[model samples]
Target: MSAHIHAQNKTTEMERNVLLIEEQGSFAVGGKRIVKDGNFDLTNPLQPDGQTYHGDHAYVFYQVPPKARKYPLFFLHGAGQSKKTWETTADGREGFQNIFLRKGFGVYLLDQPRRGEAGRSTVEETIKATPDEQFWFTQFRIGNYPDYFPNVQFPKDEASLAQFYRQMTPNTGAFDGKVITDAVSQLFDKIGEGILVTHSQGGGPGWFTAIKNDKVKAVVAYEPYSSFVFPEGELPEPIQSTGLFGALKGVEIPLSDFEKLTKIPIVVYYGDNIAKEPTQVWNKDHWRSGLEMARLWAKAVNKHGGDATVIHLPEIGIHGNTHFPFSDLNNREVADHLAAWLREKSLD
Candidate 1:
C-alpha cells in the first residue's frame, strides 16, 4: 500500500494544485488563506460520572469554519498520542490538514480514551473490572519481543526508528485500550455527525465510534489495526497476543454486526517505503501492522459489499518521497505532495 516518487512532475502537480485550491479562496494572500476565526474550544461536555473527572474528559475543535460543510471529519488519536500528531507525525510524511480546513469540514480532535488522563483511573478501569466485560479489552499480546510488554513499551532498538513510539499508559494496558473507544463513542454522540480519520489501534475504537453515529459520511483509516478482522472470523495468530486482543478472543462487537451503521463510505490506507514495491519485505517487517491491517480492511469491506481501496502510501507519497522524510532533504517535496493530496481528495 505504498509507492515512492521523484521530485519532477509530482512537485509541479502538487504546487499547481495547491495554488489552484488557494486561488479558490478569493481572500487568500501569500499562498495562505485568511482563515475566518475558528474559535472552537476544548471542553468537557460529558460530566464526571463513574470514570471521568471534571476536566479529564475534553475535545479540541480544529479549523471549524463559520459555515459548516455537508461532511466534516472527527479524528481520534491512538494511545499516548495527541491530535497534533496528525499535523506533525504519522508517516512522517506530510498530509492533508490544509485542504480539509479550506473545504469547510469541521474537524474535532477528540481525546480518545487514553492514559495520562483521569478517564483511565475512573472510567476505563472501572468498566473493564466488571464481570460483564471481562474479555472486552484483554485480547492481544506482544509477540516475539517480550521487552515490549506490559504492552506499552516501544521497541527497544527496532533496527532504526523513523518515528518515536508514542508514550505508554501508566500501568494497565486494559484501560489504555478501552478508554479511547469509550471516549470516541461518546464524542460521536456529542458531535452529531461527521467523517472519521483514524489510524493504528484507534481503528477498533474508531470503528465503534463511526457506527454509533449515522451522520458520519465516510471514514478514512490509516493502516487501521485489525481492520482485516471485520468480516468476522478468527483473529490472526500472531496478533492475538496484544493487550487489546479481546475482539479476537470473541469479547466485543464485530464489524459484521455494525454493517448497517456505516451510513456512508469507508476507505483504508497503509504506508510503504519509497524504495521497494508493495508488500516488499522491508515494509512487511518494519510496518507489518499497517500493511496487514490494510489487507484485513480489504476483506472486511468486501464481506459487507463495502467499497474500499488500498493505496500504496509510497505511491501516494507526500512530494514523491518515502519513509517519513521530514528530517531528510526531501521534506519540501513531501509537504507539497501532501498539500496537493488533500486538495485532490477535497479532504484535510
Candidate 2:
C-alpha cells in the first residue's frame, strides 16, 4: 500500500494493551498455608492464590486508522520518559503518534516495563525518587545552568519548561533489560512482524529485540547511545555481563550477533548540534562520537550483507533539532521524512 493512501481516514482508533508474564518459581512466604481468622488464609495475602505474576507489564498504546501501513510501528521512548513523550510534543502539538497514524501506520507506543503505566514490578528492588527540575532541565538539553543549547529547539519560556518537566516520570528502579527484551520479544511474536522505533537509551532494548527476534522487519532508532552497541576497543559485551547498559536487557547474544541484523533494515537518526562544544557549556561531543560509531556499525552491517543507514540531520540540512526531534518544532517534518524512508524501503 502507498503511504499517501493513508491520509484518507478521518478518524483514528486506539487500544491499550498490557503484556505480562506469569511469575514462576517459589516466593518467600507464598505456598505456605496459614490458618488465620476463622478460615485459612495464605501466608502472603498478596498472592492468596497459588502463583502470582510479576508485572513486567509492557503498556502499549496501539493506534491506527482504517487504512494503515502493512507493518505496525512500535515506538520506544528514551530514559526518564514515559509513553507520554510520544503522545504529545513538548510544545503541546501533536506528536509522532498522530503523524504516523495519518500516514497509515498502526502505531504502538510502548511504556516499557517499570515506566509509566507499566508500573513497578514485584521483582524490582527499589524505586528512585524523581529528579529535581534542574536535573532534567540540564540532562534533556533544555539548558545547562541558565543557558540553553545554542539555537536549541526546545521551548525556552518558563511555562513551556515547566510543562516539559511534567512529562518526566520518576526514574523507576533499575530495569532488567532481560525482562524488557523478553516482553518486547513476546509482543513481536504476538504481532508477527513490525517496525521498531527507539529513542535515546531505548536503543539498547531495541537492539536486543532486533537481534533476537526476526519479526522486527526494520528499525528507526533515534540516537541510541552508540557506545552501548559499538563500544570502543573491545566489542560490547552480552546483557548478562553488562547488566542493562543503556536501559537494554542483557542476553546471551554477543556483539558479534549484530551481524544477524543484516537481514533487518535499520536507520539511525541523530539530531543537530551534536558536535557543538561552546567553552563552558556542556559539550555534546559524545553525541557526535556515538553517531560516528553508528556510521561505522552501519558500514559493517552493509559489509556483512545487511542494510543500515545512519543519518546526521545537520548533514542533510535539517538543523536545529534537539535529541528528541520527534517532539521538537520540526517534528512533523521529521516524521514526514521518516515515513518517506519507510516507503522507500518498501516497508510502508
Best by lDDT: 2
Candidate 2 has its poorest 10 consecutive residues by lDDT at 23-32
Q: What is the TM-score of each candidate against the true structure?
A: 0.54, 0.78
Q: What is the per-residue lDDT of model 1 for residues 198-266, given as tens digits with 9 covering 90 to 100?
A: 756677666665665565556666545553444345344443222223223222356555574334466
Off by over 4 Å in 1: 1-58, 88-99, 115-120, 123-176, 233-258, 261-263, 274-283, 315-348
Q: Cα deviation of 200 in candidate 2 (Å)?
A: 0.8
lDDT of 1: 0.44
Runs in model 2 lying further than 4 Å from the true structure: 1-51, 128-131, 226-256, 276-283
lDDT of 2 by residue, 1-348 (tens): 554344432323231223121221211111112322343346756644544355666777676555456898888888878888888776788888777766667778788887777775645456556557775565455546578877777777777777777887754556667667777777788767999999987888888888889899999999877334542343433222111122222223454666667888899998876653312333354454466557767776787788899988888878777778899888877887897899799998
User: What CA RMSD would candidate 1 show?
Assistant: 12.8
Clashes of 2: 6
